[model samples]
Target: MPYDGFKDVKQIVKGDLEQYIIYQNEEVELKKFDNFVNLNDVLNEMEIHLKAYNRVASIQFYGITQDPETHSYMMVLEYEQMRIFEKI
Candidate 1:
């Protein structure tokens, strides 16, 4: 992901994502993703990509507050975007 020209880029923040489990009989797969942007536009763009690619299995966002009590702009976004490769 690119964050060039993102003026409000203050302190660096990290993101965390939950696990995604996919199972079929005796087959299973897991996927995870994290969002590392503080801007709303970037995050929205990601949502668009997820929908377009059909990779949006599940999503979650944490730690978004504008109160002065918080010390950091930390947040965590979790998503499941899976890709499959098979022979036609």
Candidate 2:
């Protein structure tokens, strides 16, 4: 299910390899790593967080895109079966 107070754009933090976006949620803070993060690492990280919420079934990576105006990058995440959050 979609988060109740979801926002399209959240806080952005720039790093050498990735831009991190911390998606605000009532239940937990969801992070989107917009770079070449290792898939296994991402899965492992998500698994730890997802366990805190009983509603979350799985986490899926929806790939990445670059903003035309800012040239910034974003990675998308889907929680459970709902496309609730994206980062850029």
Candidate 3:
């Protein structure tokens, strides 16, 4: 991937549903499309679980990853400029 044009990514897209890396900095190298999650079936329900203040999240990670220090299979959700962490 080209680092020069690396924008602050919000979501990874697979057809209709989308996701993005939870956090990206010059030090972190996230592999795009390493894992693709199909949220088409569960997004609505997921939003219900993670929603806050009536704002629905419309972004996710392109791949499933563990927080290096946590080492757990976690889901990173982004919406309304906030990031939500959930264990799946």
Candidate 4:
């Protein structure tokens, strides 16, 4: 199912494309996609059973272009510019 819950598609499209680290803020080389994959479909597939630790301000999608062509796409989620206090 598509990530229909997100009312705005622009949230993912507007952000700039850059290398983003996965959990624990570690940087790793990832593959990129070509031929224009659907943004919503990619997001929805990724969100399955994913947990959010901090407040999310926006989500960004990026394409890791390559010469040999390995993977299809890469998605990045950006958090809001605010402090998120843990509910201790």
Candidate 5:
């Protein structure tokens, strides 16, 4: 389900979600995703997690891939267009 960057993002945030459910750099399948949880929670959490390591002025959410079984996701977030993956 492709979400409109503007309207959909906000809807997802308002939904019941858990940011801690997000995953990174893990060996998992992306072909499938968990329909049970709102991915927005993961996105929100990912952004929060990123801020912990680096100083992020702003984040332009791009894309994501979720592992169906574990219900966790892995994504590459550049350090605010610095072309850096992440500090940690």
Candidate 6:
């Protein structure tokens, strides 16, 4: 599925640069970026999990936003079948 944009980033908290959210099936998946984690690392990790459940279709980075309140960056990831699945 094509990235619909940042329409999924629910909120941005201050002082935390590693936390983000993924909206799926009327639910939210809270995710954290480990210290020094890069975009490629995140994608690889997600790919493994998606493949485990046979839900892998496509994945992409939707966007990145800096929270004015926290000055932290939020990275949004978009997925195809995985997002549509009730469980991931």
Task: Indicate the worst ten consecutive residues by lDDT in candidate 4.
Answer: 79-88
Cα-based TM-score, every candidate: 0.23, 0.29, 0.24, 0.25, 0.33, 0.31
Please write out the lDDT profile of model 5 over residues 1-88, one tens digit for every residue. 1211112111112222222221242211111223437777666766665575356444444457554447656443332342232222
In candidate 4 the C-alpha lDDT for residue 19 amounts to 32
Runs in model 2 lying further than 4 Å from the true structure: 1-8, 12-30, 33-36, 55-88
Candidate 2 clashing pairs? none
Could you tell me the lDDT of residue 69 within candidate 6?
46
Measured by TM-score, the strongest candidate is 5
Pitting candidate 3 against candidate 6, the one with the higher lDDT is 6
Model 6: how far is 3 from its true place, Å? Answer: 13
For candidate 3, give the lDDT.
0.36
Model 4, CA-based lDDT: 0.32
Residues 10-86, candidate 6: write the lDDT tens digits. Answer: 54433322234444443233333444246566556555654654544454544444444443334444443334433
TM-score, ranked from best to worst: 5, 6, 2, 4, 3, 1
Give the range where candidate 5 is weakest over 10 consecutive residues by summed lDDT.
3-12
RMSD of candidate 1 to the truth, in angstroms, is: 13.4
TM value for model 4: 0.25
Candidate 5 Cα errors over 4 Å, as ranges: 1-36, 56-63, 77-88
Per-candidate Cα RMSD to the true structure, in Å, reads 13.4, 10.1, 11.2, 13.1, 12.2, 7.8
Tens-digit lDDT string for candidate 3 (2-71)? 2333346444434222444324543222322223245442444444444541344444333334433323
The better candidate by lDDT, 1 or 6, is 6
- Model 4 lDDT per residue over 1-88, tens place: 1222222222222222223234334223222234546756655544541234223432232222222343345443433321231121
